[model samples]
Target: MRTDLCGRLGSGDAGRAVTVCGWVDRRREHSEHLAFIDLRDHSGVLQCVVDGARDLRSEYVVRIIGTVTLRPEGTANPALATGEIELQDCEVELLSRAEPPPFPLDERTDVDETLRLRHRYVDLRKSRMQRNLRARAALNRAIRRAMDAQGFVEVETPMLIASTPEGARDFVVPSRKEPGSFYALPQSPQIFKQLTMVGGVDRYYQIARCLRDEDLRADRQFEFSQLDVEASFATRDDVLGFVTRAVAEATVAVAGHDPGTFDRMTWHDAMERYGSDKPDTRFGMELAELTPVFADTEARVFQAPCVKGICLMGGAETLPRSRVDELVATCQRWGAKGLAWMRVVAAGTGGSALDAGVAKFLSAAEGAAVIDALDASPGDMVFLVADERPLVRHVLGLLRLELGRPPVNDGRFNYLWVVDFPLFEALNAEGEPIPSHHPFTMPHEDDLPVLMSGQPLDGEALLGLRSQAYDLVLNGWELGSGSVRIHRRDIQQRIFEVLGIAPDDAQERFGFLLDAFRYGAPPHAGFAVGLDRLGALLVGEENIREVIAFPKTQSGADPLTDAPSPIADTHLQELGLRVLPPA
Candidate 1:
């Protein structure tokens, strides 16, 4: 419809007659006779000179035929890519007219999210949204290319499938034909991709759409996409390599630089050191052990089984007493009995010393030891939690991030492979160990005897068993997880037994998968990367919705379409369903 894009004309195109189409971004009147129009398309905005009689307004779709010429001296806009050139002698053809936008279209305005989502079609026209969507597209393209280069065959999986337990509620589709039967939307292609490995597809990949009936958060939604991959005859390292190469390529395509290599940390170490399986190693307010220092203390508060603290550099100068009190309350809310705080101040000897209302509770030696253990310097603040080991890690871990974690943009990429996850997260009410990843995850080779042993496995023994599972974490976000599959029927059955799933229950839940293995299943492993989270991180968006085209609000409501609306009784009857009144 046009000879060139509005933003594509440059100084080299000077004296060339061109027809460009775009929406008027901004209009500036030079005098009674002349005006400047910033015409915009997806490429960018371009300056166009037109007669004031044209009455071009913001968001007016227009096509123009003009000669591209260098901008007049002292009038060039250095901010724009086409700053050096302007379209002159223009004839404008008005295509579509728009009312004044409900809100500003520029990034400077922080529009209410609900209002923006209500007019998402219009909101997507802003440059930031355009850039984010394009970056996501580029990331997807790069991932596909890298996977193909590594001999993976792209495959499509079913959207509506039978859903077994996957740790999240499923969005089920009722079948009219069967009346009472339902098909659950996939939370992931976890089973289908694994089945592909059993079907002899050596390598398979899919950018699968997944749906989950879970509460929405900044990084989550009812529906999302994952780069799902599975391979037969592959070890855990082999699968990690496949995903790393693809992720590195995608990162380079969107971030413009290789993140280099990912570092490895055991799940146990992550929980102990940073209090999270997905640790953000970008900054240095790490948790410090203080249990030994207080073991012989007379202070009752410091005599707990575990004691840990985090040193916030310069926190003493910034955090007032009221703020420290708030932090203590927050820790109590997070399941701690209480949080202890100490301010590091100059001592009488000119060394660091603790100063707080609670400082008198500790002896001078105890105070000096606390300072030494935390590497406390003057102007530093120390937060300590003394409780059970797990609670201490949990409280201090969150405190560390709350005090020192940088904004997502300032925190550079620090990819980590968290491995050696325990086979069971914990024991259930019946004292049976809960599966960490899944029943199919292979036990560590050395731990096979513990699983196969005829001895009764108690909670401690079960919790100590390690799985061959691994998770890929980026900047404290868990991107995805995978594990080496247990192909042997005996091993799979043994895991099921340990989890208290009787033979009949195991057959009922995963009989198809087990049956498929009987036909000959090769050893396999796989991983999935959340595309929304990855795209958001790459583009410096804190929320995944920024990179999505039409995302539901945090409440899972779509203001644009007003979805989750009512259905007619007639249609409900046809579907053999009835809506009940709210309780």
Candidate 2:
């Protein structure tokens, strides 16, 4: 180790003798008496001129003592941080010699992901991974600071807790002490944070680790982190304010700008206008209702349950006839009966220019109505889907994205809140209801009487009930959600009744939490932000794996350690466990 990092050296250190240590990025031999080596550390790379023997190779960890000097005229590397100066008269001491990397250490192209993961220790040496992980750490620190400033106390929740078969499948741990029993990992600190509120910790937070035994995607991992928070006697606005402050802090720390006041949209508005709970309000092509436009039409299909369309300006030229067929096939795959489309042709005629798809199903007047309703201009393309309202939204939503409708960046953060979601969805004909957020979420005040009425709800009535829940969405990704909790036992019991969880079953599954409520649970609310997703967003990475230091593959395998491997028989026997042979 020397007096400076290889990257931090500059012309200001000229005529100064300094020591630097790092891996040799590259070595160039001009002559036997003079050779140059690019020295690299976490900070960056520096060029070193050694007027002696040249034995350096890539990844050879070395220390150098040399005098910094201005580079010869016309020899400056404007691309490098230390380009203006080079270390001369260097004495090199090899600390470690590294074998040639399996993949080039400086490669910028795609490498086999599995291979890179297997050699993850080597893969982490790349500059991109370094920057990503660094940004994550800095963002985490920023989150902690924000929580601290907000008078929140960080608390640790249990890793081995009782399993609540409510949300995602849990990764269970066999309890040797209790022979056939098991402890499940926490998916979120949901229960414990609420318990903290019951224990009178008015404001609480935790940078908690969570696990879920679910299918993996780019944005999901079996084990992830979140900023868990809970507060007693807090209103919906209070929780939103807290989240905004923390999110702003994290975003500014990484992106170098504060996302001004986040926009708000009701869940109904999001779904109606953009066809998603987390709408990407970045660009156009908003979904338009064509129900009224076709209500009086003789076309049976077009006048049916619901009709929605999107106008793709200039899409007629950009997207070909084949693309329309592909899009229609995609919609059908998503359960749509069929996809309807019309490409507008610019003509100096006295009638409509609708050229294809269901154009035959409409009169010139109906076609004109469709054109004016979607605001279609010359050469524009209109795509429509008809079915049940939800299916219509779902199909058009998928088509909108397929047509390149997504988040619009306004040179800043597109932070937003989606609120007033349905409290329950129909589970089945057995009369069981699925709580949209969870069983304990407080129903909207206006819907309180509906819940208290004791009248069994079915279909639309159940779906129409809204909850106090809110989700923080950024660029179409749902960052996190929170809601006011039902502090009263009666309201909680009503929810349990709706979910078909009898008093006995409720006590058996959530006995501890319910028992805690018996001791006067306070009116509390909370939110947990997916730290991985937040970090990925701040770093502008679509996949959360990029920001994670050691991310699992989509298959949930740890390539580096080859984890989830078979355990020793003796070890399994200690816990009275055995691995069954594959069928």
Candidate 3:
């Protein structure tokens, strides 16, 4: 409310009488007559010299008018932007007095998340949170600009709509007008954005709020935001290009560097090489193939349809026996029959040899073969899993991350586009192939013949069939996915038939969409970027909640608002709802 911001006063403003308003970050006594007050605003902190007797405490809101002057020799705080100058002979006005903070406000403090969340109004004053919040705003703005520049129109989608279950459990809202009906919150602008394409909006976009009644994790929350997009008459490459442009622009805008061209990999290759569809390619420790190495072995543990191992460089010395046992327990918990660990040691012939775990079960030649297969160094520790291919990949993928994955922000950005996902993940008990993305996804053109054939497809052939779906992954986190839509009704019906969804049942669930398709739906493709995850990555935060302004705790409770609390009986009755006892 004055001549300058606290942080905006520098040496160039020397001899200038300026006024500044901010909260008192710190107060220190310099002498009986003078004191130093670190006045802070969103920009930064500025040192103000005031009367020592003036009452000033941390977080006290105040305004000061003083002449900017150079600090005494050798007292400059090079760490601060206004380090070279100080505001002297200040007139202080106490705007508001603040009580002592419940927890330390410094960046070094490790306050419990619940405590911080409960006092979020205060927690937000910290520099880290301030930076994160501002970065998110900037990222959103950049995304909007990118979309707009790409000739996409921003459209708002409905917050309440009929509950058509997709993947995650929907957070339903009771319809007050209709006694027993409910409206579900949109998980994404997925359907509405697609509808926009059908309605002839060639390109559509929105920074949509999404909700899912799902378990919370570091990267997931019940409520989140995404950059939703859809475009009519767009091919797979067209959608990828649009999404890449937006994301790369946002990354550069927030992180100040281009991520260059995003790398591409087939889902099969990704799973085979790194054991994850979203592979973290920043570091090594790749899963090694060892099934053939033990094809003729006597070790029962290694006698499985699939066997894979990962070498933890220098893990032999870093991981103790207890830690190795814990890894074994962890593998077992992940459904592996047993985890086989071998610490590479010097052999009689100077080459490395496998020692410990399943080492004794193998012959000398087999032991050497195991060591060679994994490319294990003498000081390394190798963990092996033997089971079906899927189990082996799942266990070893997690194990690889446990052993060698870098911190979320430690490595350079490695944007990836994973394509060629299976058209169906698996077959259900009724021998119907489960749709991977959705029933509407267009099967890859090359696989159309197989689908069109009258002969029933086998589980292997169905599972091997690739859809046109693709995912945008960053550092092992799946940002979002999209696929080309089947514009033709016949293709859609055929997909439903494959999934064992009868015409009547399909009509009931997706009647509106099917009816719209009869009016000539255009071929479209789209993608959504999880803005929360992207923001977290841009700000170097491991948890998406850190970047979110007000986020639910891991238990999905909002400490600030005390949300999810019980409602009054009268309120529930208004919506014709009643609470029921737990079974």
Per-prediction TM-score to the true structure, in the order listed: 0.98, 0.96, 0.97
Q: Which residue pairs in model 3 clash with each other? A: none
- Candidate 1, 311: how far from true, in Å? 0.5
Each model's Cα RMSD: 1.3, 1.8, 1.4
Q: lDDT of all predictions, in order shown? A: 0.91, 0.88, 0.91
lDDT of 3 by residue, 1-583 (tens): 7878877778998999999998999999877788999999988899999999898999999999999999999999999999999999999999999999999889998999999999999999999999999999999999999999999999999999889866889999999899899999988877788789889999999999999999999999999999999999899999999999999999999999799999999999889879999999998888888899889878888889998889998999999999999999998998999999888998777889888777888888877777887888799998889999999999999999988889988848899999988899988898888888988889998998898786788889899899999999999999999999888887888888889889999999989888888887999998888999999998899999899999999899999999889999999999999999989
Off by over 4 Å in 3: none
Q: Give me the overall lDDT of model 1.
A: 0.91
Instruction: Estimate, for each residue in 1-583, the C-alpha lDDT of model 1 and write its tens digit.
Output: 8999877779999999999999999999987779999999998888999998888899999999999999889888889899999999999999999999899999899999999999998899999999999999999999999999999999999998997875899999988888878899999888889899988889999999999999999999999999999999999999999999999999999999799989999999999889888898888788888898888989989889999988888989999889998999999999999998888999888999998847888888888888898899999988888999989999899888888778888737888999999999988788988889988999998898988886788889899999999999999888888899899988988888888889999888988888898999999998899999999999899999999999999889999999989988888888889888999
Report lDDT (Cα) of residue 161, candidate 1: 92
Worst 10 residues of 1 by lDDT: 404-413
Candidate 2 vs candidate 3: the TM-score winner is 3
Task: TM-score for candidate 1, please give it.
Answer: 0.98
